[model samples]
Target: MPGHAGERLILTGPLRLVPGTTEQILSRLADLGRTVSTEDGVTDGLSVLALSVDDVVLCLPTVIMDGRPRRWPSATVDRRIDLTSYAFAEPDLISAYAPELIEHLNVGHADQMRQLARHARPAETEGDIAGVQVSGLDRYGLDLWRVDSAGAEQVRVAFRQPLVEPRSLGRELRRLLDQSANTSE
Candidate 1:
């Protein structure tokens, strides 16, 4: 069950307004290699920044908290994705990017309502606001979420679940790289 777990972690929490907290987070994220290629660039939180941040290129878990869950934790909002997801992706960026799996949930489906809260894939978000389609290779693209600032906050982080396992992707990538190198020589 461990290997088959849906996703691994849900890294979403409000940035407590403390001294230097923002700079610390931004500085650390900045060190994570931002620019990967001419076509791919990563950034801190906006699309027009010029510099880009590369997706961690990690295989992990994803957590999704539906805004319209049959029950409300405190407020009454329907057809909306709650704090964690938005707080994770917006103020971020808006563009078409190739998505990578960052956070994941141990499982994705459930049998009961309460079980859903316990079971389901955890969605981890960071860096930017984007969308991810769980299955399919070359699966489409990353769509940036539009945040209009309504006294609240929002974020968009896209985590795509690859059709193949991470191990297999490694092998295939290695094979391709090797082939390319051989041809170059």
Candidate 2:
């Protein structure tokens, strides 16, 4: 595969609770590599990125470290997340959006990841979900965006609640992205 340039998208607002340690997060990210197909998953490895909760920012290609209330940009988002505010929603959006990636999955690449990230953080824009400020999202949450290599975008729910249970939503999104190709053509 040839090297490709990437894009930068971010998720702003409030962060959720991180479940693990930074060391563990780094190690897991390293092991997971860039492609989800190559990753073993958090069950066997580490959520690495999951550790972030209230301060977590799920950008494309990689995860970001939360700044202490003064992260260059604003503290929370007005309505939608933004770059620099959190980081890229689909850190992989760039590579996935490559012209070559056009045939990679049935679903659209960069756009798909953005869609999922938005859906993952669905909560009270009032800045409170499950008693916490819904700041950012991670892989575990952005599932709706996932579509097979060739599938079409078929979003079901427009909004989500609880925010936590929906964390599992990422699985469904991934499945969709992985199967999107099959569904499209």
Please give the RMSD to the true structure for each candidate, in Å: 20.7, 18.1
Local accuracy of candidate 1 as per-residue lDDT tens digits, 1-185: 11132422223333333234444645555688543233355433332222122221222333346753233234332233344554475321111121233211112211221122111222321222222222212322212222222221222222333323444433443443454456445
Model 2 global lDDT (CA atoms, 0 to 1): 0.37
Candidate 2 is scored at a TM of 0.17
lDDT tens readout by residue for model 2, 70-157 = 2324333323344444445424442333343324322444555543433444341233221211222332332232233333233343
Best by lDDT: 2
Candidate 1 residue spans exceeding 4 A from truth: 1-163
What are the TM-scores, per candidate, against the unseen true structure?
Answer: 0.17, 0.17
